[model samples]
Target chain A: MNDKKWIIAGIVVFLAIFAFPFWYNMGKAAPAPEVKLTEKAKAAKQCVMPTEYMRAEHMQLLDVWRHNVVRNAEREFVNTEGKTFNMSLSNTCMDCHANKADFCDKCHDYASVDPYCWDCHLDRSKENE
Target chain B: MNKHYLYALLAVIVLFFVAYVGAEVFGLRIIFGVLIPYLAVIVFIAGFIYKVMGWARSAVPFRIPTTCGQQKSLPWIQPNKIDCPNSTGAVVIRMILEVCCFRSLFRNTKMSLEEGDKLTYRWEIWLWVFALAFHYSFLVVILRHFRLFTEPVPFFIQLLEKVDGFFRIEVLYDTIQTGLPGVFLSGLVLLAAVTFLLLRRILLPQMRYISLAADYFPLFLIFGIAFTGILMRYFTKIDVTAAKSLAMGLVTFHPTAPKGIGGIFYAHLFFVSILLAYFPFSKLMHFAGVFLSPTRNLTTNTREKRHENPWNYPVPVHTYDEYEDEFREKMVEAGLPVDKPFEKPPETLSDEKADSSA
Candidate 1:
């Protein structure tokens, strides 16, 4: 083949780039984050909705809760099971799952999602420090 | 609807449903999520190398660059260095422009008949615009996806994400509000640009006449991928944490199929896998082929340098001396001058003696 050196070099570059993720994590172990629930959360036995629904749709639900509380001036949230709770992230959600580091940041950091929730809401964990 | 495009669309739809049913209904997440992706990556790498090697093996015996401007000739004449490159440095700059900006396509023009029955050509720039948009946005989207594959995603990727999501567009509905209100413009631009390209093929008569299933299939397949991606992100939100876990698992070679990732995610993944497997065999190989194109890669230095054909071989020829030696008698009979006079050999003398004896 003509230009054998260039062709081989191009192929090498392509393979190296495409296989970047494999080499980047070759020796490092990255197990899925296991969120630690607080004693209060364990006692409640469940979140506002089912575990599966909360796991998937919690961000959307929180957004809706924020809109309701801040814009619409409505503070009460009724879950699918007809149970009512206050529509405040700081008061209601964090009251149970208080350790933001162990609960929220674990999965968020693993997933690389920097949610702007902390922009408005106070991180009580950091407030003490 | 063209049958070619219809077949391509049908194929993509079939693939989507197969993945959806395979994952959602038949409960084959492991196969869809793990096995197929790994197999697809292997096929992609192998096929790509095979195709490029095939191209590389072909001999380019001449400098056949498609020159637009004046070539290098007289010392006094001004030569277009970028267009008709005679040096390696000029060729490299031209190649960079061609690959990065689609320089040749930028000069595209369309011809139409005017009222006077004369053909007039006009600059057509939309194809160039959308093509650039499509490629850049696709690149950004792919780079941004590194977040899913890597833990504590690389700094450049994170920076790209922030810049891509800088325009925060708040979309609110009565019941549901858009979470992570940062609207990724690249995803939307990719969809729009691909839609434009597909529409150009369907709407233009010239393009439609030349377009094949190969052209339509990738467009439909990419549209399907982008559509499902947007659906998952904005509307039918999946468990991104679980999705990331699955992506990280695949990259780390510890493949895990996390639950509650939803069928749409699988469909997106299946489309991507199909694209990867189809790349080397399809027109998408142009991504690699463009770099190896002789017309673009080679410098126009035929005048200054020699390009010998590698296949050239020695040819047996009748020299002037051999020709004169064979036709010496004939030349003498025809009153033509000869370097050496004709002389009869012993074989002819014996033949004459036999004739006399007979």
Candidate 2:
């Protein structure tokens, strides 16, 4: 009954700020990154893990890889698919993906994720391109 | 009240500290890093909306604004518009000042007894000054933490950092930075203000008598958070990269517990989580309640307008025709005028019988 136009405006502004995350994520989701395999990677037979398992648990694999390679100075990564590769993200994963911006960044940007891999590991693939 | 405050403070401190210890020392990373943070955020949002909606639904039944100056009345009178608002524009301006600058709090008057019988009141400035300092510092600290959540951070946030961190001043021959670059001074000032507030409550008998656990608990909790934060920043030196990664992970729903992040980091985080969860249900809701407060929000225009209660129901009434009918004979005896003269029915045997009975 009272003149609450400004009050209403205040509420709306507050809600816009308060519900920022919801609005930001309204039509957005943690995207399923499209893994475009490089020519060399596609030619190779076995990956470290299958696509589904890697999608769900790649971070854990990377963490384990970090512990093994960094702390213990081990160099080999044995895959469940009966194959072995060097334990490294930049050297192994980036070697295959080749394009960090198109391949690795698609999902990270979608989810607002900032990984620490780039803090130490330089994206050498992009430079080569 | 004292017992409640003490117990609540102790409980929050012990509980949060233990959770932190458990997470760090025992490697219960999932709870601290992911689950608890998510729960707290959800609770804070839901509870905040529920409380605000509850206040919005309440009906204000009277014009009960706390006016401290002249109201709108005679044409010749000069109304203090902000202090005693009678229009929407005035109310809005007043509210902005109240919310942004805590205008009402700034007008606080401290009362004390001087020389036994005499009483004195003075404009209190220290409470307002410290309160302002505490809030602005806390705000800066919060804004500064946004860098941890976002990648490449925003430009405005960077600017804010510059402003917050700029503590350089010239002293005679040389300009020197007195505090840690960005947030140390604000953090320390907030802590000091909170300490002063707590001391005031404890030392003053009148304030102490009125104080409750509700008052002390938040102060102690905030102090604990600040203390631990300062420790993490200065002494222990937790891996900020790891902490940021964990924060980003939580935000993105891909939580990662970076190794060697330390328990102190988790402890600071635990305290924050507790604060978020507790904010809506507690007096901290005044953050929203200030806008809805009837005494402060309503206009002072009761004289010019007739406020009809919408809920008022109709009641039966007696007509003048009915009253006249009942009192016609009495009106004739008292020589009072009536709409119609009473008929004298032959003043006969009926009148004699009535007189005998009387």
Q: Give the best candidate by lDDT.
A: 1
lDDT of 2 by residue, B71-159 (tens): 88999999898989999788888888888899888989989889997899989998888888888888878876766665545666667
Model 1, TM vs. native: 0.92
List TM-score per model, in order.
Answer: 0.92, 0.69
Docking quality tier of candidate 1?
medium
The C-alpha local distance difference test score for the whole of candidate 2 amounts to: 0.73
The parts of candidate 1 lying over 4 Å away from their true place are B179-181, B318-358
In the range A1-129, model 1's lDDT, one tens digit per residue, is: 169789989999999999999998887768788999999999999999898878777887888898888899999999878999999899999999889999999988887777898988898978766
Computed on C-alphas against the true complex, the DockQ of each candidate is 0.61, 0.04
Residue B8 CA displacement from its true place in model 1, Å:
0.3
**Model 1 RMSD vs true structure:** 3.7
After TM-score superposition, the amount by which residue B352's alpha carbon in candidate 1 deviates from its true location, in angstroms, is 18
User: What overall lDDT goes with each candidate model?
Assistant: 0.90, 0.73
| Cα lDDT of model 1 by residue, B220-280, tens digit | 9999999999888888878888898899899998899988887889999999999999999
Separate clash counts for every candidate: 0, 1
